[model samples]
Target: MRFFWSTLSAIFVKDIVTELRSRQVLPTMIVLGMLIVWVLRMASEAILTSKAVMGPVALWISFLFSGLLVQERSFAAEQQHDCIYGLLLAPIDQGTIYLSKLLANTAMLCIFEIIIVPVVLVAFRLGPDTRWPALAGVLLLGNIGISSVGTLFSAVVRVSRARSSLLSVLVLVVLMPMMIPATFALLTVFGAVPETLQGTGALSFIGSFNAAVGYMIAFDAVFVVACWLLFGFAIKE
Candidate 1:
């Protein structure tokens, strides 16, 4: 167990250091997120009334697009010097490798959210009355589901020639259903809309944010474990 964890930490550090040196994914995530929000805001400027719904929707759209690109870039970065090859040759468990990648992706996504969340709040005029800590917690849960699944799909389609398109299709297809719960959860958490606890099929972001967070955590955990178990086959293919 200690060896597995140690190996996971080493790979996680390797990825983080490599990303910092390259300065690739973070910049793109920041840039893309900002550009998308700004553009969307500008586009909606003509509408005089509320941007109430558009705000969170726009924020998530930016997150989804930027996240997809960054996930692809995560593996692409490994291709630069065949770094993944070296990792593969190491006596690390395949599950450890998957977990390391998931953790690294989650870290990157969290940083991206840190930058993007403020932009989102300011752009949507949601700053003053908002609960920063609660918002952060909600976003973290949502991103866990996103990055965990994305990291797995990114690995699955790592070496494909048409990786971007394929990954975008697959990730969006799988995750779009999640957006209903996520959007409502965000809306509820942000207090953009009224509470939805009355009837949300058991999980209620309105009355219980923890339930929503736990739901996403469960979602991520299931996928992460599945990917960790299947990653060796993915590598071989």
Candidate 2:
């Protein structure tokens, strides 16, 4: 038990230190995210003057693609130097490796959100009425959803030359339920519409915010457990 926890910590720390030193994943995420935010800002002013409505959609677009960027490269880095195979040669279980990847990806996404969400808030002119705490909560859940499924699918396609494409499809399909609601709820909390009209027209309908939050938490949890069980098959040569 002690060894498992320690190994997990080491793996997580390794990813953090390497990323910090190299400045790969997060830089791309921030630059690309900023670009998306800027484009959205221009579009909002030029096309739709309504800040509330467009903010949510634009935010989702940024979040989804930026996350894809993270996941695609997460394992590719390992495979590049054949480091993942070295890790596999060790005594650690595949589940632990999966969790490490999941944790690292989730942590990176949280950090990205910390930086990007504020930019998003300012860009959309979301004022004092915006529920910062609630919005942060949603972003946290959304990260978990992305990381849970992403880790498994990343491992599944890690050996493929077209890994980026394959992982994108698997992730988007599994994640659609959670991301759609999280987006709508985020927009709602930012004053896109009243609670009564949570998923109405002109709004990408999923369901109520509270309900969406509850479901996504469960949804992510289930996938994490499934991935933990299934990752071994995905990892083997």
Candidate 3:
């Protein structure tokens, strides 16, 4: 237990320090997120009154792209100096590698959210009101699912010749089923017409979505573990 915790901490710290030294990922994500929100706001401004729904959609869209940016780098960094092989040579379990990578990716996503959410609110006139906390919860949960599957796919694609574009297509295709829960949660929080938790199926949709995705996290975790165990066989020196 202690070894696992220490190893995880060491890897997490290494990633944080390396990312800070590089300073590429976070800044690019923030700038891109800002541009996305700004563009969306400008587009919606010319539309009808009560620009309420666009708020959540803008944030989610920005977050999705930002996440892809971070996930892309997850394996790209390891591929740089063949540090991936070094990590694989380390005396660690495959699951640990997956967890560490997932942690780093999740941390990056949270940082992007921290910066993007405020910019989104200021630019789109969404206050701290109107179910912001609930929206945040859903985002966190959904990102966990996203980052898990993404960590696996990113590593898989890193070994392939196609790399970035191929990874993007494959991950996006696999992520389609997740769009419903994510969109429903976002729409409920930021839509012009919000759903209530009172009726029989009122909140059930979101609840079911959450539960289903929550169970899938374990499945996703297992898949990542399997991939980590198998990737070495596929990608040789």
User: Evaluated with TM-score, which candidate comes out highest?
Assistant: 2
lDDT ranking of the models: 2, 1, 3
Which parts of model 1 have CA positions greater than 4 angstroms off? Answer: 47-49, 128-130, 197-214
> Model 1 misses residue 178 by how many Å?
1.6
Model 3 alpha-carbon miss at residue 9, Å:
1.2
51-81 per-residue lDDT for model 3 (tens digits): 5678877877887778888888888889988
Global fold similarity of model 3 (TM-score): 0.83
Model 2 per-residue lDDT tens digits across residues 24-141: 8899999999999999899888885678877777777888888988888778889998998798999888899999989999998888988987798888877527477887788788
- Give, for candidate 1, the lowest lDDT window spanning 10 residues: 200-209
**Every candidate's CA RMSD:** 2.8, 2.1, 3.7
Q: Each candidate: what lDDT? A: 0.77, 0.83, 0.75
Model 2: ten consecutive residues of lowest lDDT: 195-204
Off by over 4 Å in 3: 128-130, 196-237
Model with the higher lDDT, candidate 1 or 2: 2
